[model samples]
Target chain A: MKNLRLKAARASLDLSQQALADAVGVSRQTINAIEKGDYNPTIRLCVSICKVLGRSLDELFWEDD
Target chain B: MDWLVRISGVVALVCIGVMVYLIVKMSPDGFRKEQYDERQTLERLKAARAGFYAMLIVALIYLIVTSFAPELGNQSRVWMCVMLFFGIGTFCLYAIFSDAFFSLRQKPWLYLLLIGVNLLTQGFNLVNYFADGGTLRDSVGTNYILVLGMILLLLIIGAALVIKMILDRTERD
Candidate 1:
């Protein structure tokens, strides 16, 4: 459930948290929760986030081994 | 801004007048005491439920409107519209719904509450129109609307009473 990768990808994009949230059609708080690994985003939301961040699914989201 | 304030003033004055009329001239004496006491519980519950339902409707509309306002940085007008909507909305809600004329029970206490709300709501209209004098001249539609509303409500109440009488007769047989 860890999403340190998502946080890293977001930081590298030079996008504000709100910008990412808006691009993904989710709330800033939802993005914040996802970055903190406190919430699991839906598949649709995950795809939206990946598309906005210009990253592949594996690069932005992965379970910790 | 001034119009908003003026409208609020008129609304408040009308509400105050209704309260005064209810306190002074409103009476539940035209109906039988036995029937009024019999349905006291039903009457109170229905009034409370209808009040809550009406307020809930206003609150939902306010929430939807305010959500739009914050996005555009026009929160002031949004607040004004939402506030006024709820204010007048709740008053009319109580005016329209709290009446016993719509009650399923057709009890005498419902009739009393029906009469009380009608008096209060119309009194609000009368007071608002006259207190500002005819010079204000904006309450014409409100007056006609309330008068028509009251008449329709009376008809409903009369129908309920007829139904109650019929039911009571059948039960006695």
Candidate 2:
């Protein structure tokens, strides 16, 4: 369940994991965990990441059936 | 000689007190780092759980061994202390490498400082042991176990740091 959508969004912005983590006030490892599907972030963090990437939650975290 | 031991003992006690104070006051979120996010906190809890179970198993084994071998029972306290030290060390090292203690972006100098202190104390213990005409058999007490445990902990931390550095470098490249 890797978040390829989020990764692509981050890449489009030229943001490294550490950069995004800094923007979100988290460690790069936390970002890595999210991308790797190793951890599910809270909705609050989801909103934060969406805001940083200029993406809506649907764009970054939502999955289609 | 007695005075030297007493002074060093007091210094060690003071150092432990300072450590407790820092841990209690500074580490409201554990390890006092901003990088300790939810994921890292979860990892820390997992590591703690694992360490606890491992320590329990080791203690049980020690109990069984000592009970079976009464001669070895005399050294039970030393062995138990060493096991506890290593158990806690494993938990800490796990947390550190997992980025639960400090963010990878932040330098973990406190851990390095702790390793250095452990080495220094080990040196002092070795010198004192020799100064007291202590034989190899006499080196099986609390002092010896403490030094050995610290050395093992130091090695684990050093290895973890090296691995982390290499990983970071590779990621950067």
* DockQ list for all candidates: 0.01, 0.59
Q: Count the backbone clashes (under 3 Å) in each candidate.
A: 0, 0
- Which whole-number lDDT from 0 to 100 does residue B37 have in model 1? 19
The weakest ten consecutive residues by lDDT in model 2 chain B span B134-143
* Model 2 bad stretches (over 4 Å): B1-35, B103-106, B135-141, B171-173
C-alpha lDDT score of every prediction, in listed order: 0.57, 0.79
lDDT of candidate 1 over B1-173, digit per residue (tens):
99999999999999999887776555664332222211233435565566566657766766776677655333444343444444444443343332322322244556657766776776677567667663322333444444544544555544555566465454320
Q: Residues B60-165, candidate 2, lDDT per residue (tens digit)?
A: 8888988899787776667777678767877877786776867545576676777778778786887788689764333355566666666777777777877886
**Pick by TM-score: which candidate is best?**
2
- Fnat, model by model in order, equals 0.00, 0.57
Q: What is the DockQ of candidate 1?
A: 0.01
